[model samples]
Target: MTESRGQAPRSGLSYLPGEAATDPDGTLTAIGRSWTWILGSAIATLVPGVLVLVWPDETLHVLAVLIGLYLLLTGAFRFVTAFGREHGERVPGLLVAVLFVLAGVLCLRHPMQTVAALSLIVGLTWLVSGILTLYAALAAPDLPHRGVVVGVALLGIVAGIVVLAMPTASARALTRLLGLWLVLLGIGELVFAFAWRAALRRGDALPGAAGPMD
Candidate 1:
């Protein structure tokens, strides 16, 4: 039987006037196109994270400098990716990027003080990064493997809270935790990058759209 005019489709796919249409395929294609940037960002994060973990015996000053550089580079990469050809929304990425940069600068300018307040600084950074990542994962319906992204973000938030709750923790412990978190985050991104590549090769359509519910 023919449906009546002005009625919603039986499939339940409905869109309001002036709303942007869902483009699952386009979204996937965009991600595939930006694989290089994504992979680079992941590598950039992973390398320093590994260095930090392997050289745990380093002095507090060295630790501070390394962490600061890591944060700074990570932030810069994120900022670039947000404005790059592949990213969806710019705001969330921008906010995360700024927080990372600030945290890095703070560490560098006052290395001694940073070591003294390592827990607070690292905790705040993780919390902020996690929140932003969670926001992006949920908001960007076009993002592939969103479940994994959410998982990673939650890990970051939980780790941050744990560190903050124990402000008196030793510098060595905090450094280790931070390194582990960065490594995990990097791995997550790498997974996402490869997944996107695979999907693109298979010509898979990512579910959801940049528009309102349909």
Candidate 2:
């Protein structure tokens, strides 16, 4: 989500597609209110991260498979979320989805990949997604809860950097680090979702906010 509900910042949303914010004229637009998919994306990430954390003893192969599944699911979530954006804004979401899917594929197909290889794939995806998300947040100052959006983007950027910089010696070590970041990312997205929901509610209660949804 370059702007809300969708990116690698992708599943929990390294980007939202606007990270679907991009609401012009200071009102909550349809896309701005799309918190459901955001929640779905968060769940996709949180579950996998939690699973990895709980099962750190799992082999590298198992870790790869789990990560692969998370990426694929995130890709799917991002893909659907892309449509919530303006046509011109769809490209970023679609791009993130592709990146996630490709990474997932690589992970699943080659579970025996070295720790560095796996880290490289995931880190790159997150880095790119975070950059896109930051771009969207900067470009759209009017985006609702812009501060939260920026915060999430920064978290993603940091997560990417840390993972790339600290390729752990073993699968267990990597598992702990990745799980922590994923959980943090998921929490960020979860907050964004509820924030959007609250904003939508407030907007609906406004004097003339019902026109778009109808």
TM-score winner: 2
TM-score of 1: 0.73
The whole-model lDDT of each prediction reads 0.62, 0.67
* Candidate 2 lDDT tens digits, 1-214: 2322322121111222242344443223333235666777888888888988888788889889988998898887776665555555556667777888999999999999876777788888888877777765665545667677778888888889998988855666767888888888888888877775665554421111111101
In model 2, which runs have C-alpha deviations exceeding 4 angstroms?
Answer: 1-33, 204-214
| Residue 91 CA displacement from its true place in model 1, Å | 0.7
In the range 96-195, model 1's lDDT, one tens digit per residue, is 7788899889988888774448668877887877887787678755555567667767877886887788776677777787678778877877876666
lDDT of 1 at 29: 26
Which candidate leads the pack in lDDT? Answer: 2
Task: Give candidate 1 regions above 4 Å deviation.
Answer: 1-33, 84-88, 114-116, 203-214
Model 1: ten consecutive residues of lowest lDDT: 205-214
